[model samples]
Target: MPRKSLPALSRRMFLVASGIAAGALALPHSVLATEPEHTAISTLAFDGESLLAGGANLVRSDDGGQSWTELPAPGPILALATHPERPGLVLAGLASGGVALSEDGGRTWESRSDGLPEGEVDAVAVASRQPDMIYAAVQGDGLWKSENAGQSWSFAMDRPWLEETEHDLLTLASVDLATGMGGIWIYAGTEAGLTRVPDCFCRWQDVQPGNAMDALVSGDAPPSEAPLPAGEAVRALASAPSAPETLYSALPSGIWTSRDGGVVWSHLVDRPASAVAVHPSDAMQVVAVLDGTLQMSRDGGATWTALAAE
Candidate 1:
């Protein structure tokens, strides 16, 4: 079905608070006639021109943020990863115990959860170099892998990280394989911190404190509508395809960028961003979602301009 843009907020109030001209802002096109009650956007991925966003709802957009289309999937989407080589191939990790694959640009979807444990799927990663390789992090199951392009699955990690602590895994990102990173390096974001698992899936290491990992372990009753805690609680993470050494992490304070391959980091943005994605064609072009608002940056995080939502 066609997507619906968010409800129009008070433009006069927004402009007075943000000090921007309301007339200059472009309104979002109503992709759907009616908006759903809950829309928890957990992850976002781009396929050159179009964007695939997963959360409580599965959605796609071809004209940046101007218009969106809702894509029906098997279950509530928690994570999404687009195929590196195949433009239309996309995979979605659901809150239920399975993953969904779409070969025809999300017009239709099929479930692939033969080996996945019956639990919420927290994270997913597609190997940029090895397009056929897929990885998923199950809430109670450490990690699962699909080598046949989501056709079949196997346990990638011997032990599940979710079992080690009460916290749950939230996000996953793969480093560019061409950088000699060896295999598709996967980074798992959790309440404890950031966990690094080599593509080989031999061992997992804690790369949170010393490394550029910043995270927060929320209590059972996390705030229903509040941003994560500052200084900790990694809201999101994205790796640059052009520069493997540089990765960006979203924290409560703002966004941080690391140039030394997750070793050293520097602050990039001050506003809290819940999700971020870099354009595949232009590494410097970035789009971030903050508190239901979308912002864009073309100068590699140097400056940001807010995109209006209608």
Candidate 2:
């Protein structure tokens, strides 16, 4: 029998995840289109030229959005990532099923949540340059690391510095890997702000408006929608491989950018962004989701162009 189908494992998972409710939580409030609710798109990832989307289920398009096929998964997928250079390596974060890894692209999968505290995976990320390293953001849980690919996880937030953090209440909305001139860094979207972690994953910080606020105060771009609040929850985030220092962070106030890594942040636009994805090869190109609409930006998210559903 397949290891994933083991009777004990299945029974435990069913009890732990609470079945359908957990799977539904993996998705953002999806747009209720005339189309079937199961087909409503949520988030997106790119594997080569193929586009993969998830909401209530998993779907893929090899030739852009001209055609899409529903893909089988252990449960409803919440977030996904594809290896940049690897032709057949995919990782998925499930709503209530934890994380799964695939060596034959999306054709097959194996469970990889041995040490995860919670099976509700909110986001997943993998750097193509080093495929063996992967990260998973568990909802309400701080984060988990898997050094040996996605075989297992070492729960974070055990550090003393994170003791003050309410990882149980703070929902990790999104996570992305940044690599380039500055260095390799990990970005996570949270209710407070966009959080960043170093290569060692020993410590972390968030995007603060200290020095960057000076530029905004002087009217570099424009006055923000309102005064920055005491706490800002990040809706989504994306980082380009070509520009590691650059981070696009979506906050309730608007979208902001960090040029010198995530140290300083400046408001770029005052538009709501629910989700974001950077181009695999081009840092200047980015895709964002706004009110369930697809928008693309070729100028490093400085501007955007809306894309109608196909």
Candidate 3:
């Protein structure tokens, strides 16, 4: 979910049980045509043979990238994810920080973020090991979690960041233990730095060894010059299912990579991407979004495919 403008807290529960609203896919007129970069795809994923991307609205393309059809959302969606074990159970995070569930793929949606946080949604993810476990990162809030899908939620932030700064959490990435080596890894990309909690009951500590991320999460050491600048956010995060240790992050500076979990890091490129995802089976295949355009790097980062319109 794009977080340029966050709605007020009073408008938290948008239980839009009604069917798809009117003008769900209205294209802008020629007079108001904007550049492709302005409509960057905020999030991307592959659901079976279909490609789903979220930005101004949730759009789906059954025939790859040839064309796309808009799926109605309560507001500009910032986050989207599918249940690993349950097909057709698509989860969407709205700009208002509300969560919606789609039982029939993307055809219909229903708000289920009743007990969740109140703000814009930055990212949403489901654990493959524990299929029922769902997590959301609220833009102006900390973290939220739900055990029974999105029907209900609770604040999952374990530290002071939960209530101290509403805008501390920016994005999140969860790696299921069943698919990975073992043990769950929930990475919370925050303004202070990246924090990691092994499981739902573990404590959160800065993933970056000696970076400012540590200071931001621990409040022990003075700000240190880490790869991430002071107060720079970890905007988007993704991990391949085959190799969960190989993590990717879209940071304020640029794309950052971690080969052995989040231990060591190096700046990949200065071209900032809003979100990134690696092919579940192929490590070489990667996709990222710059501005509103989508691009692919099939052969590692040596070359990139052309930017495609969403």
TM-score, each model?
0.75, 0.69, 0.74
Candidate 2 accuracy as TM-score: 0.69
Higher-lDDT candidate among 2 and 3? 3
Provide the lDDT at 139 for model 2.
Answer: 66
Please give, for residues 1-310, the per-residue lDDT of candidate 2 as tens digits: 1111111121013223223322212322322221112214445666766666655555555644444555555566667776666766778777675787777656556777778876567677785357787878776555777878776678754321233565421223223333321235555665654455545554555443333333323544332223323367765666655565566665667666766556556776677655566666776766666544566677866777764343
- For model 1, residues 1-310, the per-residue Cα lDDT tens digits are 4545322222111111111121222323424423221224566777767876666555677776555676654555667777546788777777655777777766666677777788777677777677778888788667788888777888877442443454555677778633223635686666555556667565565443322211222212222122223226565677777666567776656766666456556778787666777776676777776655566788878898764432
lDDT of 2: 0.56
* Candidate 3, 95-161: lDDT as tens digits: 6557777766676667777787577777788875666778887765667889888778888874325
Candidate 2 residue pairs in backbone clash: none
Model 3: number of backbone collisions:
9
- The regions of model 3 sitting more than 4 angstroms off are 1-38, 158-167, 177-182, 208-231, 307-310
Better candidate by lDDT, 1 or 2: 1
Better of 2 and 3 by TM-score: 3
The 0-to-1 C-alpha lDDT of every candidate, in the order given, reads 0.62, 0.56, 0.61
